[model samples]
Target chain A: MSHQFYSIECIIPPHIQNNIAEKGTPEQRKKVMGSISQSAAIRAQRVLLTETKALVEPVTVGGKQRNIFNLNFGSNLPGILARSEGAPPTGDPAVDEAYEGAGATYDLYQQEYQRESIDGKGMRLDSTVHYMKGYDNAFWNGRQMVYGDGDEDLPEPQRIFNRFTIALDIIGHELTHGVTQFEAGLVYRDQSGALNESFSDVFGSLVKQRQRNQTAAEADWIIGEGLLSPNINGIGIRSMKAPGTAYNDPLLGKDPQPAHMSDYKTIDYDNGGVHINSGIPNHAFYATAMEMGGYAWQKAGQIWYVTLRDRLTSTSVFADAAQQTYLVAGNLFGGGSLEQQAVRAGWQAVGIQIDAGDSGGNGGGTGGDTGSGGGTTSPGCSTALVQLLDNVKALIENRSR
Target chain B: MKISYRRTGGFAGMLISHSFDTDTLPKTDAEELVKLVSAADFFALPSKITATGADQFQYTLTVETAEQQHTLEVGETSAPENLRPLLEKLRLLARGKPDL
Candidate 1:
């Protein structure tokens, strides 16, 4: 392979490589192991360069950097530069909100979890507001945050959503997608997709709680507080504390989230109910945070963050999440500690019983397959490697275009 | 002929949908809708198209005539170029209707 090929492949984290070895097809296994060996040879030199650079650079070299843009009711992204880091806030509420929300999210990850930024490599946060006239959505478009005006162009009584940037947790949730893209690279469908959404909600809620200086007990655990118009019969978009009760309106259908394994939805829409079944894991995290007490970003958030960055693979399922989080808590706070118990109890409340004797064994029987489960042990080319290859191909295709 | 459009899975997780029969619309409006459907070649598109991205919208568009009926589910990122105008028009129409 060319040097550039090796450089790109080498960036696949070691844990993901191990996952590929364990679960990948023979062809993929061979390819990844070859790259891993090549990576090992150059790893020392890279480390030396990193150390030397760290010594030469200031301690705040990776400080938070944010750029906010305005689409001005157009679909084109990063449309016009409205604000930049450390600059005076423009009076535009969407621009200022996006800027401040990014800062709050960055601070939660940096101060509490010691992460530099969404990518943990100090990637600059970029956001665009006013995506389209009366648009009612926000998303991380694989590169940066994009916010919609959320029916603001409509008359007051007809409007359902406020501006997308109205809620800090919503901003955190979108940015966390970038973190997941860089970390687990979780497949965006089925059980893995639900896990992906759940992690975002977890950290998103933590960002809000930390911003308001509220303890886990005091926080509302709402994902998009104040994002709904007063005429809408809903408190927010999704409630972590109570998944299905966030909204019930004549205009917007009832929230479809289910709070337990027994109620796991198996619909065809929403990418196999990514937003619906997520309620199970969302409630689990809420339960864990409440059990741990104090600031959620401290203990519960730490356990979940370490699990996301280190333990999870692209195809990991809810059972894998249950098992890995339990193991991670034990590892962090000692076996049989209160923190470990809290983790176990959290999953238990959501109908997933973590096997105390499993000890993070290879696979199977951490908990019963809760409908479309067992992604980690499935035999095939590793989904993570396949996703990586697909991403590279898409990048090439886009560049060629 | 009847056409129905439903959108779901945005950040808000709200579901909005609308359906209309050609007979119920004004003649001009019905002809315009027919032109959009044909211009987009809606029947020829795949039944499902997905793209990687979180919180993007998912749309389901269904068209029915005396001869056949077709439905397509697509994520915003993977939506075909020709289908964009049809999707936008349907979205606006759906927004005008009461929640389904």
Candidate 2:
């Protein structure tokens, strides 16, 4: 198995696609199936991308540079440049939304976390709208953002999916995947993969919250707020406040997310339930934000940002993330403070016990397998085994020295 | 003789299945399917596909003839190129979509 270098992060999960294929009309089925194939083909392209070294110059403008493209129902990427920085809106909903959403995300990272951009180096934000004919999904293809216009051929009741660019949080969610790629570089598989997904959701919520200036209490923690069609029995794709309750429809099926570690899925599919089990950490973040009482991005988001940017390695597990955030929260806001306590409680809410006293040996230390690997976290050898081996190796090397 | 195919798992996690009885199918299509199945050596295909990530569809083909019945499973990304036409036809039939 080769090292899994990149990931295709989509707003709609696979289970939802499967549900549509089974229950949707013949036209809907064709659209959904085509989306599945398109996404698969993009994943295949991602593998090829890793093989080549593409040079991307860091943007050093006033802040961020946003470039929007229109696929015009075609497959080619970054198709036609619809808008760019300092340009007026083209009166197109998708283009305007993508531009504003990218700007909002940049502002959140810029003003809150002081992140230059998704890469912390002012990387130009590139997006493509109307990716394909009757496409049902939007995704970050480990490179640029792509959105679909949503299926228009289905009947009103069967029209359960809206345009991909309809939701601001969904845009934030997709862009955060790019942030994860640059920072944690979380291998998109297994527990670490879930962490990759959870981080994206966490920050995605933050971007939306900061944009609306909504507090944790005031904000609706739904990830894809307006992305779902009105005819569906669902509110959104995934709800951070209530994981499994996000959607329950005859066509979409029930949301399969588990908010606690005990209920975590251990399936071989979906890269070990990367998108499904993310509910655990997502709830943890939501809890932490609620406990902090105010804007979530202020304290809770900061801790997670610091953890993602500095503390987490590519192979860090849920426990490692929980522990690292606990340590970082204390460091950011004095030990035993309300912020620190909230961080500790957050992990505990998700069945991950992070000892308050455990400062994690060395602060911000690279634990276990550092960069991307074969996308699999070894069985039974989790954060504990990683720490143990590190200690053993340290002892042997010190003795020889 | 009966030929059945089912496709499950994708971004939406949908399952679509259809069966074609040799006696019920058009003579030309049935002959083509048999030739395709035999020439493609459906039985030799792998049982399960290793998915690279999310949104992958899994295809299961079941063929029953006078001698025996056989089942073959392949993933969307891992399936051999030879099986494309057969899988495409099966998906269309399963969804009640026009194959022509």
**Stretches of candidate 1 exceeding 4 Å from the true structure:** A1-62, A358-401, B26-35, B38-48, B64-71, B80-82, B96-100
Q: Write the per-residue lDDT of candidate 2 for residues A1-401, one digit (tens) a residue.
A: 11211111111112223223444677876576444433333333332342232235334354789999998876656699999998998999999999999998888889888988766667789989987655556667666677877665456665667787888887887888888777656777777878888887898889888888999999999977877687667788788999888877666677788999889988755557777888999999999999899999999999999888755655667876887787667556644567877888888888888755433222222221121222322232233334434554664575579
Q: Best-fitting candidate, measured by lDDT?
A: 1
Give each prediction's DockQ, rounded to 2 decimals: 0.45, 0.06
lDDT of 1 by residue, B2-98 (tens): 9988887888666677887889988876888888889889888889998667999988889998888899988876787778777776776677454
Docking quality level of the chain pair in candidate 2? incorrect
Q: Residue A161 in model 1: shift from native, Å?
A: 1.1
- The C-alpha local distance difference test score for the whole of candidate 1 amounts to 0.78
Predictions in order: lDDT: 0.78, 0.69
